[model samples]
Target: MYRREYKVSISNYPYCNKKVDVKKLEEELEQDSNEQKEAVVYIHIPFCAEICDFCIYCHEQVVNNDKIEKYTNALIREIQEYSRKSYVRSLSIKAIYFGGGTPSMLSVNQFDRILSVCKECLNLVSDVEISVEVNVLNATEKKIEQFKYSRVKRISVGIQTFSEKTRETLGLPLKQKDLLNFINMMGQYEFPVMAIDVMYGEPCQEKEEIIQDIEIASDLNISHISLYQLCVIRGTKLFSRMQQFDWVQPDESMLYAMFNVADDTLQKLGFYNTVIPEYSKYGKESVFWKDNFNPQLDRLSFGASAYGYLNGRTYQNVCNVDTYINYLQKFKVPLDSISEKVTVLQKLERDIILQSRTQVIDTKYLEDEYNELYEQMYKETLQEIIDQQLAYREKNLIKFTKPGMYMQEDIAVKFMKSILEGKSRLYKKMVIGNQKI
Candidate 1:
């Protein structure tokens, strides 16, 4: 079972198993405020015009206008409350992200209203990169117009595969015209980063179809392409639907072949997305991606089921929409849980795994910051992966090979497995938060 979890998302590492108290966490934030010099704000909208079956994100169908309006009010209140805090008031906002069930579910006014409040209340920097995740319904001219002269610098859409049959299998709405028009209108605006998310390795999926999706999107003035591997989480509607398929589903080899094919296809078209799935044109990358790992920034996430990190502790908001609103109505914090303080070793481990997204690791920095022993053990682990042809060492740097890039999560797991097998000194200190920490 431990071996099976080798491919788990590194973002979820230093996993929390113990229950957390909301009031205690509130106090922790207050204490961390002095240390939190900068911030990245994430607003979560839980309503969607429609729900996709394969999505594991916290989301629900938009039942009515009343629910959305109320949720919007709660989000504004949350932001307002945070802005008044000593920590938030003292810090500068480096990035603002509107992620969601479908951020487009909010009216252009509602979206702008929230943005307006964030700008008015928070201490945002001049170059603060604001990003929003929109859905298919956001294809309207009205929606695209809302971004004109506004602060949102990045727009992300889930274009998961263009094949009609695959669309039905994944349970996305069938209207491609809306999506195309949305892209066309959005293309008119030159946001620094406009990305379309596409998935591969699905039932009855073909290379030709995936390639077409990439080409069409890239031609539509997309600045970035985020390639996702279709992993149907258990209990999702699509998870059950996939089991009903008659043909042999995608296996490891097929998944790798499809990914490599897409990589080649995108490279031919001038995208720089080699190391990780996020490929971009014009030397651009998402600001939120870099800030998420930065030790100096605290990501304060609002709304239902949003995750945030601050002062070495990661936390999440309530998943229940009504409950979230009720807590905020009384000016209370609606928290689900938070992890215990992250140790220095765990922090380095996290930095290693996530920096893999860039496909390079600086061993010199590790030795200098942590210790020579840690750097040595990490190199040993890299050597083990090198033996398997997933990564290689060049002087003081460790970099991922093509296959390693495709299987990033699994390689991160392999690092943990290596630590447990032979590097007990480091693993012990990592788990206990001792010695150097």
Candidate 2:
């Protein structure tokens, strides 16, 4: 909040050094701890027909039919294993998201088989938000029809940018004209939500390109838009080719301008920012995006490179397809890592961070619930941010200005660090206990 060099570190998931205790996870689920939450599922289909330069998410290109069949079988078996756990039986599934390299690439029969297992195993609640990610190339009418038959609530298509040059630069194989036609065709259907992804801050894209992307999406009558900024992550193909292309990353000022344009233009067009990147016409309830954005909701993930959150812990499956299949077939949970228990302070910070990403944080609840800690945060963290013109309080709600949204992560981190350093009265009272004061 003070714009110091200090960083705020909140534990979304804690790291444990010991070997993963698969049996321990099962035991906790079977015992039915008081903290058990209604869970959501994130199934990762890590196969793409081709890889994009900017994509750093764990994935592989479609290689063979046997591998796909093997992966699908393993994924089902993994879900069944969770079904056998006691806590899972008691919990009602809020949503199930099929995300990945290309979930829609699976055959219709494969979709039926996997969904049938979900019907048999999980307590899928009525009106569940069943969403699937589909690449435009693979978003066939047959597949869309299959999604409809399966009662999928939303379809996510990532159209990073409409610029043919940019798309080609990103390694997209489809022609720009064909891509537009495909999206239009999908929108004509009666799906509950047809969300499209528009990206900004790419290597050579200007602000006008971003505006055009938004304009095109709006024209298509797309129900939702996920506006994202391009990032050059380490270990990605983009990172490796940064020098070859002489990719000039946009400075903070340029990036902020792009964000403001998108935010203003989209809002005027009747789409509000539901989360950091997602803008929706029907508000927050339109899709299950909230479950992933809100820290309070527990998400259980499956398949290669999938991450899951339960109780106060987070875990991920193995990244390799072969390894994931082997682990599941051998009757072992394909857990690559499991986090340690999250702390109270970390939880508090996460709640504020996630909530404030889209809307203001209502301090009244924090004041009544956390009491002294809330007071301390107000004085040492929140007040300072207000003074810096980063955020403002409207009665009980503290909201970030447009400029502040760009630095949301950094600001959240600063506040958390202040709390950790005992700047709060609550911290001093509970931790130090009048040792010297």
Candidate 3:
């Protein structure tokens, strides 16, 4: 078994202090003959009436109409600017996601205008999977109707928990009844697919509470669920309250219990394939699963503090509204950071990590496509994973046994240890700490 130790401080280097000139990056990517054309667009609408204490997303409290108008205009300008440079009008966009603060908070007119601008700029493919992330409180009949009229096919609603006590602790504004009513209305309309976002491991959450949340979701016949463990991101109200809370963040044992409960419960409810470590559903995993290769798909992000994956690289937009608006006003791309240009090695590692999390990795696929790289790492570290019983080779596939899945993060860290050390040999050795995945 893999040894469990105190969390090591894995340096977030390579990703730190990196910014890309959006125009330059796009040009470079466009010139790459090997670049794939399939694209996904993400629009960030960062206006929220109230910021959740646990939320670390780049968002602002918008209490005034003027600020909303200004933000919308800025978003439009950013879209227009990107369209001009990327020639997006001629490209087929496969998916468009409106996420953050509260995408549904926009007035119907504003939402329509934004969608219109996107259509004007990008050639949205017929049957493009359009999704909008909404806060339960902000969703209304008019908003849902407008979204349908705009051709939005998916709605990802944030309903972290159904327990009133947990909801209060989470500072969620809506009640369980309101959230259920919203889900019921969506079901009545057959809103293509409704995905519920749930959270676990909250400060005072009990096992029963989480199970109740799952039961409620399954009863509603929600098409998909994105279950996430509560994380203490650095600058959030929840982070500040972490100390005073009597509840303990689930330890490795507790996490295993939580994961098993959810997995078993969801499977019994006929939600089969685990899409991501935290996502699952009954039918074909959502549009996000297309192409099968996790990292190959493109993601375009909009809004304050939104991150997009495109052309084999990741870029994040400015997190502050004023900064975003200011940059757009100056006819510049509103970007804050461009994470490191992902190398082939990094891509392979990502695939390994993602596959390993599911308790399976296609060893033949790795051997066939990445023989040389796979051999090098297999010799160096893969043996250890096998020895620890975290992974085992089964014919052409390397699968993480049941016990292995619970400790997948630790295995990934072991792989990362070598890579990170090689990349920054002179830097101080930082260990991965007790942070939850």
Question: TM-scores of the models, in the given order?
Answer: 0.88, 0.88, 0.85
User: Candidate 3 — which residues are off by over 4 angstroms?
Assistant: 1-23, 29-36, 86-91, 289-293, 354-360, 378-380, 402-409, 415-419, 422-437
**Which runs in model 1 stand beyond 4 Å of their true positions?**
1-8, 32-36, 372-377, 414-437
Clashes of 1: 1
Give candidate 2 regions above 4 Å deviation: 1-11, 14-23, 33-36, 283-285, 376-379, 415-437
Instruction: Give the whole-model CA lDDT for all candidates, comma-separated.
Output: 0.74, 0.74, 0.69
Error of 2 at 430 (Å): 30
Candidate 2 per-residue lDDT, tens place, 36-83, comes to 467678889988877888886778888677788899999999999988
Ranking by lDDT: 1, 2, 3
Write the residue-wise lDDT of candidate 1 on 53-87 in tens digits. Answer: 87777887876888888888898998888777666
lDDT of 1 at 276: 64
